[model samples]
Target: MRILVLGATGYLGGHVAERLRALPEATLLYGGRSPGADLPVDLATARPGPLAEALAALAPDAVVNCAGAVGGDAVALAEVNARGPAVLCAALRQAAPGARLVHLGSAAEYGPGRPGTRVGEDAPTRPAAPYGATKLAGTVAVTASGLDAVVLRVGNPVGPGAPVAGLPGSVARALRDAGPGPDAVLRVGDLSPYRDFVDVRDLARAAALAATRPGPLPAVLNISAGRAVEVRELVRGLVRASGFAGRVEETAGGSTRSAAVGWQCSDVSAARAALGWAPLHTLADSVAALWASVAGAPVPAR
Candidate 1:
Protein backbone atom coordinates (compact mmCIF):
# COMPACT_ATOMS: atom_id res chain seq x y z
CA MET A 1 0.00 0.00 0.00
CA ARG A 2 1.11 3.54 -0.77
CA ILE A 3 0.25 6.18 1.83
CA LEU A 4 0.38 9.96 1.85
CA VAL A 5 0.67 11.74 5.20
CA LEU A 6 -0.28 15.40 5.29
CA GLY A 7 1.47 17.53 7.93
CA ALA A 8 4.42 15.16 7.72
CA THR A 9 6.47 17.61 9.78
CA GLY A 10 4.05 17.55 12.75
CA TYR A 11 4.37 15.47 15.88
CA LEU A 12 1.80 12.77 15.12
CA GLY A 13 2.10 12.99 11.34
CA GLY A 14 5.85 12.48 11.46
CA HIS A 15 5.41 9.37 13.60
CA VAL A 16 2.74 7.99 11.27
CA ALA A 17 4.94 8.59 8.23
CA GLU A 18 7.91 6.88 9.86
CA ARG A 19 5.71 3.91 10.74
CA LEU A 20 4.42 3.69 7.20
CA ARG A 21 7.99 3.80 5.90
CA ALA A 22 8.89 0.89 8.21
CA LEU A 23 6.05 -1.20 6.87
CA PRO A 24 7.24 -3.72 4.26
CA GLU A 25 3.93 -3.57 2.38
CA ALA A 26 3.71 0.19 2.39
CA THR A 27 5.38 3.13 0.62
CA LEU A 28 5.09 6.58 2.21
CA LEU A 29 4.57 9.93 0.46
CA TYR A 30 4.45 13.26 2.32
CA GLY A 31 2.41 16.32 1.28
CA GLY A 32 2.67 19.74 2.92
CA ARG A 33 3.55 23.40 2.43
CA SER A 34 7.26 22.66 1.98
CA PRO A 35 8.33 19.71 -0.12
CA GLY A 36 11.16 17.69 1.27
CA ALA A 37 12.09 14.44 -0.46
CA ASP A 38 8.36 13.86 -1.01
CA LEU A 39 5.59 15.97 -2.55
CA PRO A 40 4.48 19.42 -1.36
CA VAL A 41 1.11 21.11 -1.89
CA ASP A 42 -0.67 23.57 0.37
CA LEU A 43 -3.98 21.98 1.26
CA ALA A 44 -5.16 25.18 2.93
CA THR A 45 -5.10 27.32 -0.23
CA ALA A 46 -4.23 25.13 -3.23
CA ARG A 47 -7.03 24.74 -5.73
CA PRO A 48 -6.39 21.05 -6.29
CA GLY A 49 -3.84 21.99 -8.95
CA PRO A 50 -0.66 20.59 -7.37
CA LEU A 51 -2.53 18.17 -5.08
CA ALA A 52 -4.38 16.53 -7.96
CA GLU A 53 -1.14 16.40 -9.88
CA ALA A 54 0.67 14.74 -7.00
CA LEU A 55 -2.23 12.36 -6.37
CA ALA A 56 -2.22 11.24 -9.97
CA ALA A 57 1.53 10.90 -9.98
CA LEU A 58 1.75 8.90 -6.76
CA ALA A 59 -1.67 7.24 -6.77
CA PRO A 60 -1.41 6.45 -3.11
CA ASP A 61 -3.81 3.94 -1.56
CA ALA A 62 -4.34 5.91 1.64
CA VAL A 63 -4.11 9.50 2.91
CA VAL A 64 -3.72 10.44 6.58
CA ASN A 65 -4.53 14.08 7.33
CA CYS A 66 -2.75 15.24 10.48
CA ALA A 67 -2.54 18.88 9.51
CA GLY A 68 -4.25 21.45 11.78
CA ALA A 69 -3.87 24.86 13.44
CA VAL A 70 -4.52 25.22 17.18
CA GLY A 71 -5.64 28.33 19.06
CA GLY A 72 -5.21 30.86 16.28
CA ASP A 73 -7.38 33.66 14.97
CA ALA A 74 -10.87 32.37 14.19
CA VAL A 75 -10.53 33.00 10.48
CA ALA A 76 -7.23 31.19 10.20
CA LEU A 77 -8.54 28.27 12.22
CA ALA A 78 -11.60 27.99 9.99
CA GLU A 79 -9.44 28.07 6.87
CA VAL A 80 -6.88 25.55 8.11
CA ASN A 81 -9.00 23.27 10.30
CA ALA A 82 -12.42 23.43 8.60
CA ARG A 83 -12.03 24.35 4.95
CA GLY A 84 -8.65 22.70 4.51
CA PRO A 85 -9.79 19.11 5.14
CA ALA A 86 -13.00 19.66 3.23
CA VAL A 87 -11.04 20.78 0.18
CA LEU A 88 -8.56 17.93 0.54
CA CYS A 89 -11.34 15.37 0.77
CA ALA A 90 -13.00 16.72 -2.37
CA ALA A 91 -9.72 16.75 -4.26
CA LEU A 92 -8.82 13.26 -3.09
CA ARG A 93 -12.19 11.93 -4.18
CA GLN A 94 -11.72 13.45 -7.57
CA ALA A 95 -8.07 12.45 -7.94
CA ALA A 96 -7.98 9.10 -6.18
CA PRO A 97 -11.46 7.92 -5.24
CA GLY A 98 -10.22 4.58 -3.95
CA ALA A 99 -7.78 6.06 -1.49
CA ARG A 100 -8.83 5.79 2.16
CA LEU A 101 -8.72 9.22 3.84
CA VAL A 102 -8.18 9.07 7.59
CA HIS A 103 -8.80 12.40 9.27
CA LEU A 104 -7.19 13.13 12.64
CA GLY A 105 -9.92 14.64 14.75
CA SER A 106 -9.58 15.81 18.36
CA ALA A 107 -11.14 14.99 21.74
CA ALA A 108 -11.85 18.68 22.02
CA GLU A 109 -14.76 18.14 19.66
CA TYR A 110 -16.67 16.74 22.60
CA GLY A 111 -15.83 19.91 24.51
CA PRO A 112 -16.49 19.60 28.19
CA GLY A 113 -18.39 16.42 28.89
CA ARG A 114 -20.42 15.93 32.03
CA PRO A 115 -18.52 14.53 34.97
CA GLY A 116 -18.50 10.69 35.16
CA THR A 117 -20.00 10.40 31.69
CA ARG A 118 -17.78 8.62 29.20
CA VAL A 119 -17.74 10.38 25.84
CA GLY A 120 -18.20 7.76 23.13
CA GLU A 121 -18.21 8.08 19.37
CA ASP A 122 -21.95 8.65 19.42
CA ALA A 123 -21.83 11.22 22.21
CA PRO A 124 -23.31 14.65 21.62
CA THR A 125 -20.73 16.98 20.03
CA ARG A 126 -21.00 20.39 21.66
CA PRO A 127 -17.74 22.06 20.77
CA ALA A 128 -17.37 25.31 22.71
CA ALA A 129 -13.98 26.40 21.39
CA PRO A 130 -13.27 27.71 17.91
CA TYR A 131 -10.70 25.02 17.25
CA GLY A 132 -13.05 22.23 18.27
CA ALA A 133 -15.96 23.66 16.32
CA THR A 134 -13.84 23.97 13.19
CA LYS A 135 -12.51 20.45 13.58
CA LEU A 136 -15.99 19.07 13.98
CA ALA A 137 -16.99 20.91 10.84
CA GLY A 138 -14.11 19.35 8.97
CA THR A 139 -15.13 15.88 10.12
CA VAL A 140 -18.66 16.49 8.90
CA ALA A 141 -17.39 17.69 5.53
CA VAL A 142 -15.15 14.65 5.11
CA THR A 143 -17.96 12.16 5.81
CA ALA A 144 -20.54 14.06 3.73
CA SER A 145 -18.33 13.98 0.62
CA GLY A 146 -19.22 10.28 -0.06
CA LEU A 147 -15.56 9.36 0.17
CA ASP A 148 -13.96 6.48 2.06
CA ALA A 149 -13.17 8.24 5.32
CA VAL A 150 -12.58 7.56 9.01
CA VAL A 151 -12.47 10.20 11.71
CA LEU A 152 -10.23 9.30 14.61
CA ARG A 153 -11.15 11.50 17.57
CA VAL A 154 -7.95 11.41 19.51
CA GLY A 155 -6.94 12.72 22.95
CA ASN A 156 -3.61 14.22 24.11
CA PRO A 157 -0.94 12.12 22.41
CA VAL A 158 2.21 11.91 24.57
CA GLY A 159 5.47 10.55 23.29
CA PRO A 160 8.71 11.59 21.63
CA GLY A 161 8.71 14.44 19.11
CA ALA A 162 5.91 16.29 20.91
CA PRO A 163 6.41 20.06 21.09
CA VAL A 164 7.68 21.52 24.35
CA ALA A 165 4.55 23.61 24.86
CA GLY A 166 1.98 20.81 25.10
CA LEU A 167 0.86 19.29 28.41
CA PRO A 168 3.28 16.37 28.78
CA GLY A 169 6.09 18.32 27.21
CA SER A 170 5.46 21.19 29.62
CA VAL A 171 5.77 18.80 32.55
CA ALA A 172 9.03 17.47 31.16
CA ARG A 173 10.39 20.97 30.88
CA ALA A 174 9.42 21.70 34.47
CA LEU A 175 11.24 18.60 35.63
CA ARG A 176 14.39 19.49 33.72
CA ASP A 177 14.45 23.00 35.17
CA ALA A 178 13.71 22.11 38.80
CA GLY A 179 15.33 24.45 41.31
CA PRO A 180 14.68 26.24 44.61
CA GLY A 181 12.78 29.49 44.09
CA PRO A 182 9.84 31.08 42.26
CA ASP A 183 11.47 30.07 38.98
CA ALA A 184 10.97 26.42 39.93
CA VAL A 185 7.21 26.84 40.23
CA LEU A 186 5.20 24.72 37.78
CA ARG A 187 2.89 27.31 36.29
CA VAL A 188 -0.09 25.20 35.36
CA GLY A 189 -3.69 25.55 34.33
CA ASP A 190 -6.84 24.22 36.00
CA LEU A 191 -5.68 21.04 37.67
CA SER A 192 -9.21 19.74 38.16
CA PRO A 193 -10.17 18.77 34.61
CA TYR A 194 -9.57 15.14 33.72
CA ARG A 195 -8.46 13.89 30.31
CA ASP A 196 -7.67 10.67 28.54
CA PHE A 197 -4.16 10.50 27.08
CA VAL A 198 -2.62 8.17 24.52
CA ASP A 199 0.92 7.49 23.38
CA VAL A 200 1.79 8.75 19.90
CA ARG A 201 3.37 5.45 18.88
CA ASP A 202 0.16 3.61 19.71
CA LEU A 203 -1.81 6.23 17.81
CA ALA A 204 0.44 5.76 14.75
CA ARG A 205 -0.10 2.00 14.81
CA ALA A 206 -3.84 2.49 15.10
CA ALA A 207 -3.80 4.77 12.04
CA ALA A 208 -1.91 2.11 10.08
CA LEU A 209 -4.41 -0.53 11.15
CA ALA A 210 -7.32 1.67 10.18
CA ALA A 211 -5.81 2.25 6.74
CA THR A 212 -5.43 -1.47 6.05
CA ARG A 213 -9.02 -2.31 7.00
CA PRO A 214 -11.53 -2.64 4.15
CA GLY A 215 -15.24 -1.81 4.07
CA PRO A 216 -17.51 1.14 4.77
CA LEU A 217 -15.70 3.53 7.07
CA PRO A 218 -16.96 4.30 10.56
CA ALA A 219 -18.08 7.90 11.01
CA VAL A 220 -15.97 8.43 14.11
CA LEU A 221 -13.86 6.34 16.46
CA ASN A 222 -12.51 7.44 19.83
CA ILE A 223 -8.80 6.73 20.03
CA SER A 224 -7.79 6.93 23.68
CA ALA A 225 -6.92 5.05 26.82
CA GLY A 226 -10.04 4.00 28.72
CA ARG A 227 -8.99 5.79 31.90
CA ALA A 228 -9.07 9.50 32.73
CA VAL A 229 -6.32 11.29 34.69
CA GLU A 230 -6.64 14.63 36.34
CA VAL A 231 -4.22 17.38 35.39
CA ARG A 232 -2.83 17.65 38.93
CA GLU A 233 -2.35 13.87 39.05
CA LEU A 234 -0.48 13.99 35.78
CA VAL A 235 1.75 16.76 37.10
CA ARG A 236 2.42 14.81 40.29
CA GLY A 237 3.24 11.71 38.27
CA LEU A 238 5.80 13.64 36.26
CA VAL A 239 7.22 15.17 39.42
CA ARG A 240 7.57 11.75 41.01
CA ALA A 241 9.09 10.20 37.90
CA SER A 242 11.60 12.99 37.58
CA GLY A 243 12.38 13.21 41.33
CA PHE A 244 11.58 16.95 41.28
CA ALA A 245 11.32 18.33 44.81
CA GLY A 246 10.17 21.77 43.82
CA ARG A 247 6.90 23.11 45.17
CA VAL A 248 3.84 23.12 42.91
CA GLU A 249 2.05 26.41 43.31
CA GLU A 250 -1.32 26.89 41.62
CA THR A 251 -1.88 30.57 40.94
CA ALA A 252 -5.34 31.99 40.37
CA GLY A 253 -4.28 33.49 37.08
CA GLY A 254 -2.57 30.32 35.85
CA SER A 255 -5.22 28.15 34.26
CA THR A 256 -6.24 26.76 30.94
CA ARG A 257 -8.26 28.71 28.44
CA SER A 258 -12.02 28.92 28.79
CA ALA A 259 -12.41 26.03 26.34
CA ALA A 260 -10.39 23.48 28.34
CA VAL A 261 -11.88 23.47 31.83
CA GLY A 262 -14.31 20.55 31.99
CA TRP A 263 -13.73 16.82 32.35
CA GLN A 264 -13.45 14.88 29.05
CA CYS A 265 -12.47 11.39 27.91
CA SER A 266 -13.51 8.68 25.42
CA ASP A 267 -14.98 5.23 25.42
CA VAL A 268 -12.52 3.61 23.00
CA SER A 269 -14.37 0.33 22.59
CA ALA A 270 -15.18 1.05 18.97
CA ALA A 271 -11.54 1.29 17.94
CA ARG A 272 -10.57 -1.61 20.15
CA ALA A 273 -13.26 -3.90 18.75
CA ALA A 274 -12.84 -2.87 15.11
CA LEU A 275 -9.11 -2.17 14.89
CA GLY A 276 -7.83 -4.12 17.92
CA TRP A 277 -6.26 -0.90 19.11
CA ALA A 278 -5.50 0.01 22.74
CA PRO A 279 -3.00 2.25 24.44
CA LEU A 280 0.12 0.18 25.18
CA HIS A 281 1.83 2.53 27.62
CA THR A 282 0.87 3.38 31.18
CA LEU A 283 0.73 7.01 32.28
CA ALA A 284 3.70 6.48 34.56
CA ASP A 285 5.67 4.89 31.76
CA SER A 286 4.77 7.72 29.42
CA VAL A 287 5.88 10.31 31.98
CA ALA A 288 9.12 8.43 32.63
CA ALA A 289 9.89 8.23 28.92
CA LEU A 290 9.18 11.94 28.52
CA TRP A 291 11.30 12.72 31.54
CA ALA A 292 14.13 10.59 30.18
CA SER A 293 14.10 12.60 26.98
CA VAL A 294 14.30 15.82 29.00
CA ALA A 295 16.78 14.54 31.60
CA GLY A 296 19.04 12.71 29.13
CA ALA A 297 18.29 9.26 30.50
CA PRO A 298 18.18 5.94 28.63
CA VAL A 299 15.34 5.45 26.17
CA PRO A 300 12.32 3.74 27.69
CA ALA A 301 10.43 0.81 26.19
CA ARG A 302 7.86 1.53 23.56
Candidate 2:
Protein backbone atom coordinates (compact mmCIF):
# COMPACT_ATOMS: atom_id res chain seq x y z
CA MET A 1 0.00 0.00 0.00
CA ARG A 2 1.20 3.48 -0.91
CA ILE A 3 0.51 6.10 1.76
CA LEU A 4 1.19 9.81 1.40
CA VAL A 5 1.35 11.79 4.64
CA LEU A 6 1.12 15.59 4.47
CA GLY A 7 2.82 17.66 7.19
CA ALA A 8 4.93 14.64 8.03
CA THR A 9 7.49 16.91 9.70
CA GLY A 10 5.02 18.39 12.18
CA TYR A 11 4.59 17.19 15.76
CA LEU A 12 1.45 15.11 15.18
CA GLY A 13 2.18 14.31 11.58
CA GLY A 14 5.69 13.07 12.35
CA HIS A 15 4.34 10.52 14.82
CA VAL A 16 1.58 9.43 12.43
CA ALA A 17 4.07 8.97 9.62
CA GLU A 18 6.36 6.96 11.89
CA ARG A 19 3.51 4.66 12.91
CA LEU A 20 2.26 4.17 9.35
CA ARG A 21 5.77 3.42 8.09
CA ALA A 22 5.88 0.38 10.39
CA LEU A 23 3.09 -1.37 8.44
CA PRO A 24 4.40 -4.58 6.85
CA GLU A 25 3.56 -3.88 3.21
CA ALA A 26 3.22 -0.12 3.28
CA THR A 27 5.24 2.43 1.32
CA LEU A 28 5.08 5.73 3.15
CA LEU A 29 5.57 8.93 1.15
CA TYR A 30 6.02 12.38 2.64
CA GLY A 31 4.06 15.20 1.00
CA GLY A 32 4.87 18.77 1.99
CA ARG A 33 6.63 21.93 0.89
CA SER A 34 9.77 20.76 2.71
CA PRO A 35 12.64 20.16 0.31
CA GLY A 36 13.25 16.66 1.66
CA ALA A 37 9.61 15.61 1.20
CA ASP A 38 9.02 13.00 -1.49
CA LEU A 39 6.12 15.03 -2.90
CA PRO A 40 6.53 18.81 -2.84
CA VAL A 41 2.98 19.82 -2.04
CA ASP A 42 1.75 22.78 -0.05
CA LEU A 43 -1.93 22.51 0.68
CA ALA A 44 -2.24 26.07 1.90
CA THR A 45 -1.46 27.48 -1.55
CA ALA A 46 -1.97 24.42 -3.77
CA ARG A 47 -4.53 24.61 -6.54
CA PRO A 48 -6.67 21.63 -7.48
CA GLY A 49 -5.64 21.43 -11.15
CA PRO A 50 -1.91 21.24 -10.48
CA LEU A 51 -2.33 19.21 -7.30
CA ALA A 52 -4.50 16.74 -9.22
CA GLU A 53 -1.64 16.26 -11.66
CA ALA A 54 0.72 15.58 -8.77
CA LEU A 55 -1.69 13.23 -7.03
CA ALA A 56 -2.25 11.31 -10.25
CA ALA A 57 1.46 10.62 -10.46
CA LEU A 58 1.82 9.55 -6.84
CA ALA A 59 -1.34 7.40 -7.01
CA PRO A 60 -1.38 6.84 -3.28
CA ASP A 61 -3.73 4.35 -1.67
CA ALA A 62 -4.32 6.66 1.29
CA VAL A 63 -3.60 10.30 2.18
CA VAL A 64 -3.40 11.37 5.81
CA ASN A 65 -3.52 15.18 6.15
CA CYS A 66 -2.01 16.52 9.35
CA ALA A 67 -1.42 20.01 8.01
CA GLY A 68 -2.94 22.85 10.05
CA ALA A 69 -2.18 26.07 11.91
CA VAL A 70 -2.86 25.85 15.60
CA GLY A 71 -2.18 29.50 16.42
CA GLY A 72 -2.15 32.18 13.80
CA ASP A 73 -4.01 35.17 12.48
CA ALA A 74 -7.43 34.75 10.87
CA VAL A 75 -6.07 34.77 7.33
CA ALA A 76 -3.29 32.28 8.13
CA LEU A 77 -5.65 29.98 9.99
CA ALA A 78 -8.21 30.11 7.20
CA GLU A 79 -5.57 29.42 4.60
CA VAL A 80 -4.13 26.33 6.26
CA ASN A 81 -7.05 25.02 8.29
CA ALA A 82 -9.95 25.79 5.96
CA ARG A 83 -8.70 26.33 2.40
CA GLY A 84 -6.05 23.63 2.66
CA PRO A 85 -8.53 20.80 3.23
CA ALA A 86 -10.94 22.08 0.60
CA VAL A 87 -8.15 22.15 -1.95
CA LEU A 88 -6.88 18.73 -0.99
CA CYS A 89 -10.38 17.27 -1.31
CA ALA A 90 -10.87 18.88 -4.68
CA ALA A 91 -7.61 17.50 -5.98
CA LEU A 92 -8.28 14.04 -4.54
CA ARG A 93 -11.71 13.96 -6.19
CA GLN A 94 -10.12 14.75 -9.51
CA ALA A 95 -7.23 12.29 -9.25
CA ALA A 96 -7.56 9.79 -6.41
CA PRO A 97 -11.20 9.54 -5.43
CA GLY A 98 -10.76 6.00 -4.20
CA ALA A 99 -7.93 6.87 -1.83
CA ARG A 100 -8.88 7.16 1.81
CA LEU A 101 -8.31 10.71 3.19
CA VAL A 102 -7.87 10.81 6.93
CA HIS A 103 -7.88 14.39 8.25
CA LEU A 104 -6.73 15.50 11.68
CA GLY A 105 -9.20 17.98 13.18
CA SER A 106 -9.23 19.74 16.54
CA ALA A 107 -11.42 19.09 19.57
CA ALA A 108 -11.66 22.88 19.79
CA GLU A 109 -14.20 22.55 16.99
CA TYR A 110 -16.74 21.56 19.64
CA GLY A 111 -16.32 24.78 21.60
CA PRO A 112 -17.27 24.65 25.26
CA GLY A 113 -18.85 21.37 26.28
CA ARG A 114 -21.25 20.97 29.17
CA PRO A 115 -19.35 20.75 32.46
CA GLY A 116 -19.83 17.05 33.06
CA THR A 117 -21.09 15.86 29.71
CA ARG A 118 -18.88 14.23 27.13
CA VAL A 119 -19.44 15.90 23.77
CA GLY A 120 -20.13 13.40 20.99
CA GLU A 121 -19.31 13.81 17.34
CA ASP A 122 -22.95 14.67 16.69
CA ALA A 123 -22.78 17.69 18.97
CA PRO A 124 -23.11 21.08 17.37
CA THR A 125 -19.81 22.81 16.56
CA ARG A 126 -19.74 26.27 18.09
CA PRO A 127 -16.15 27.34 17.93
CA ALA A 128 -15.19 30.15 20.29
CA ALA A 129 -12.25 31.37 18.23
CA PRO A 130 -10.84 31.44 14.73
CA TYR A 131 -8.66 28.41 15.40
CA GLY A 132 -11.63 26.18 16.15
CA ALA A 133 -13.77 27.79 13.47
CA THR A 134 -11.13 27.21 10.82
CA LYS A 135 -10.60 23.63 11.98
CA LEU A 136 -14.34 23.05 11.76
CA ALA A 137 -14.29 24.36 8.22
CA GLY A 138 -11.63 21.76 7.36
CA THR A 139 -13.67 19.04 9.03
CA VAL A 140 -16.70 19.99 6.98
CA ALA A 141 -14.73 19.83 3.75
CA VAL A 142 -13.56 16.28 4.44
CA THR A 143 -16.92 14.93 5.64
CA ALA A 144 -18.76 16.50 2.73
CA SER A 145 -16.16 15.42 0.19
CA GLY A 146 -17.38 12.50 -1.94
CA LEU A 147 -14.47 10.23 -1.07
CA ASP A 148 -13.47 7.45 1.28
CA ALA A 149 -12.62 9.80 4.14
CA VAL A 150 -12.66 10.20 7.92
CA VAL A 151 -11.94 13.13 10.22
CA LEU A 152 -10.24 12.41 13.54
CA ARG A 153 -11.15 15.25 15.88
CA VAL A 154 -8.19 15.16 18.26
CA GLY A 155 -8.05 16.57 21.78
CA ASN A 156 -5.13 18.15 23.67
CA PRO A 157 -2.16 16.14 22.38
CA VAL A 158 0.63 15.57 24.92
CA GLY A 159 3.72 13.40 24.62
CA PRO A 160 7.34 13.36 23.41
CA GLY A 161 8.59 15.89 20.84
CA ALA A 162 5.90 18.30 21.99
CA PRO A 163 6.70 21.82 20.82
CA VAL A 164 6.79 24.74 23.25
CA ALA A 165 3.91 26.35 21.42
CA GLY A 166 1.40 24.18 23.29
CA LEU A 167 0.57 24.16 27.01
CA PRO A 168 2.35 20.91 27.89
CA GLY A 169 5.61 21.90 26.28
CA SER A 170 5.38 25.46 27.52
CA VAL A 171 5.03 24.32 31.13
CA ALA A 172 7.84 21.83 30.76
CA ARG A 173 10.09 24.54 29.38
CA ALA A 174 9.25 26.87 32.25
CA LEU A 175 10.02 24.19 34.83
CA ARG A 176 13.26 23.25 33.13
CA ASP A 177 14.41 26.84 33.01
CA ALA A 178 13.51 27.40 36.63
CA GLY A 179 15.50 24.37 37.71
CA PRO A 180 15.25 23.29 41.41
CA GLY A 181 15.29 26.81 42.80
CA PRO A 182 12.67 26.97 45.54
CA ASP A 183 12.43 30.77 45.14
CA ALA A 184 11.57 30.45 41.45
CA VAL A 185 7.98 31.33 40.82
CA LEU A 186 6.42 30.15 37.62
CA ARG A 187 3.66 32.56 36.75
CA VAL A 188 0.95 31.31 34.44
CA GLY A 189 -2.54 32.13 33.34
CA ASP A 190 -5.76 30.67 34.66
CA LEU A 191 -5.57 26.86 34.67
CA SER A 192 -9.05 26.06 35.94
CA PRO A 193 -10.45 24.88 32.62
CA TYR A 194 -11.09 21.19 32.05
CA ARG A 195 -9.67 19.48 28.98
CA ASP A 196 -9.55 16.04 27.43
CA PHE A 197 -5.85 15.21 27.00
CA VAL A 198 -4.70 12.36 24.75
CA ASP A 199 -1.22 10.97 24.22
CA VAL A 200 0.17 11.88 20.80
CA ARG A 201 1.32 8.29 20.31
CA ASP A 202 -2.19 6.99 20.90
CA LEU A 203 -3.53 9.50 18.41
CA ALA A 204 -0.95 8.31 15.88
CA ARG A 205 -2.09 4.74 16.42
CA ALA A 206 -5.67 5.79 15.68
CA ALA A 207 -4.53 7.47 12.49
CA ALA A 208 -2.83 4.23 11.41
CA LEU A 209 -6.00 2.26 12.09
CA ALA A 210 -8.19 4.69 10.20
CA ALA A 211 -5.88 4.60 7.22
CA THR A 212 -5.81 0.76 6.99
CA ARG A 213 -9.34 -0.17 8.14
CA PRO A 214 -11.56 -1.75 5.51
CA GLY A 215 -14.99 -0.77 4.32
CA PRO A 216 -16.68 2.58 4.98
CA LEU A 217 -16.19 4.67 8.12
CA PRO A 218 -18.14 7.30 9.96
CA ALA A 219 -17.56 10.82 8.64
CA VAL A 220 -16.11 11.96 11.95
CA LEU A 221 -14.84 10.41 15.18
CA ASN A 222 -13.68 11.93 18.46
CA ILE A 223 -10.09 11.01 19.41
CA SER A 224 -9.68 11.83 23.08
CA ALA A 225 -9.17 10.45 26.58
CA GLY A 226 -12.95 10.46 27.28
CA ARG A 227 -12.24 12.12 30.60
CA ALA A 228 -12.22 15.84 31.40
CA VAL A 229 -9.33 16.79 33.64
CA GLU A 230 -8.52 20.12 35.23
CA VAL A 231 -5.77 21.91 33.35
CA ARG A 232 -4.00 22.58 36.68
CA GLU A 233 -3.55 18.82 37.10
CA LEU A 234 -1.60 18.62 33.88
CA VAL A 235 0.60 21.51 34.96
CA ARG A 236 1.22 19.96 38.37
CA GLY A 237 1.99 16.62 36.78
CA LEU A 238 4.72 18.21 34.67
CA VAL A 239 6.10 19.94 37.72
CA ARG A 240 6.27 16.68 39.65
CA ALA A 241 7.77 14.87 36.69
CA SER A 242 10.37 17.58 36.23
CA GLY A 243 11.08 17.69 39.95
CA PHE A 244 10.50 21.46 39.91
CA ALA A 245 10.34 22.92 43.38
CA GLY A 246 9.21 26.37 42.24
CA ARG A 247 5.80 27.89 42.74
CA VAL A 248 3.42 28.08 39.79
CA GLU A 249 1.24 31.12 40.24
CA GLU A 250 -1.92 31.59 38.24
CA THR A 251 -1.82 35.09 36.81
CA ALA A 252 -3.73 36.98 34.17
CA GLY A 253 -3.38 36.26 30.43
CA GLY A 254 -3.12 32.75 28.98
CA SER A 255 -4.80 30.78 26.24
CA THR A 256 -7.99 32.39 25.01
CA ARG A 257 -9.59 28.99 24.34
CA SER A 258 -9.18 27.97 27.97
CA ALA A 259 -10.89 31.11 29.14
CA ALA A 260 -13.70 30.83 26.63
CA VAL A 261 -14.21 27.10 27.04
CA GLY A 262 -14.36 26.37 30.75
CA TRP A 263 -14.89 22.66 30.12
CA GLN A 264 -14.17 20.43 27.13
CA CYS A 265 -14.24 16.63 26.82
CA SER A 266 -15.13 14.15 24.09
CA ASP A 267 -17.05 10.91 23.81
CA VAL A 268 -14.48 8.43 22.48
CA SER A 269 -16.86 5.43 22.48
CA ALA A 270 -17.46 5.77 18.76
CA ALA A 271 -13.71 5.52 18.07
CA ARG A 272 -13.47 2.32 20.13
CA ALA A 273 -16.50 0.81 18.40
CA ALA A 274 -15.45 1.84 14.91
CA LEU A 275 -11.65 1.52 14.98
CA GLY A 276 -11.02 -0.45 18.20
CA TRP A 277 -9.00 2.57 19.36
CA ALA A 278 -8.49 3.68 22.94
CA PRO A 279 -5.74 5.78 24.53
CA LEU A 280 -3.14 3.60 26.23
CA HIS A 281 -1.24 6.25 28.21
CA THR A 282 -2.53 8.10 31.24
CA LEU A 283 -2.08 11.86 31.67
CA ALA A 284 0.71 11.10 34.12
CA ASP A 285 2.48 8.94 31.63
CA SER A 286 2.22 11.64 29.00
CA VAL A 287 3.51 14.23 31.46
CA ALA A 288 6.47 12.07 32.45
CA ALA A 289 7.39 11.40 28.86
CA LEU A 290 7.09 15.07 27.96
CA TRP A 291 9.34 16.09 30.83
CA ALA A 292 11.83 13.39 29.93
CA SER A 293 11.95 14.64 26.36
CA VAL A 294 12.46 18.24 27.44
CA ALA A 295 14.84 17.61 30.34
CA GLY A 296 16.85 14.82 28.69
CA ALA A 297 16.63 12.85 31.94
CA PRO A 298 14.51 10.05 33.30
CA VAL A 299 11.61 11.11 35.52
CA PRO A 300 10.75 9.58 38.86
CA ALA A 301 8.56 6.52 38.31
CA ARG A 302 5.02 6.98 39.44
- lDDT agreement with native, every candidate: 0.80, 0.92
> Where's the lowest-lDDT run of ten residues in candidate 1?
252-261
- Per residue, candidate 2 scores C-alpha lDDT tens digits across 1-302 of 99999999999999999899889988999999899887798899999999999899999999999999888789999999999999999999999999999999999999988999999999999999999999999999999998999999999999987998898888889888986988998888888889999999999999999999999999999999999999999999988877788788998677965469989999999999999999998998898888888988764343
Error of 1 at 57 (Å): 1.2
* Tens-digit lDDT track of model 1 for 83-131: 8898888788778998999999988888888787788898888887787
Could you tell me how far off, in angstroms, the CA of residue 36 lies in candidate 1 after the best superposition? 1.9
Model 2 TM-score relative to the real fold: 0.97
TM-score for all models, in order of appearance: 0.93, 0.97
Write down the lDDT that model 1 would get: 0.80
Q: Residue 219: error of model 1 in Å?
A: 1.7
Off by over 4 Å in 2: 298-302
RMSD of each: 2.0, 1.6
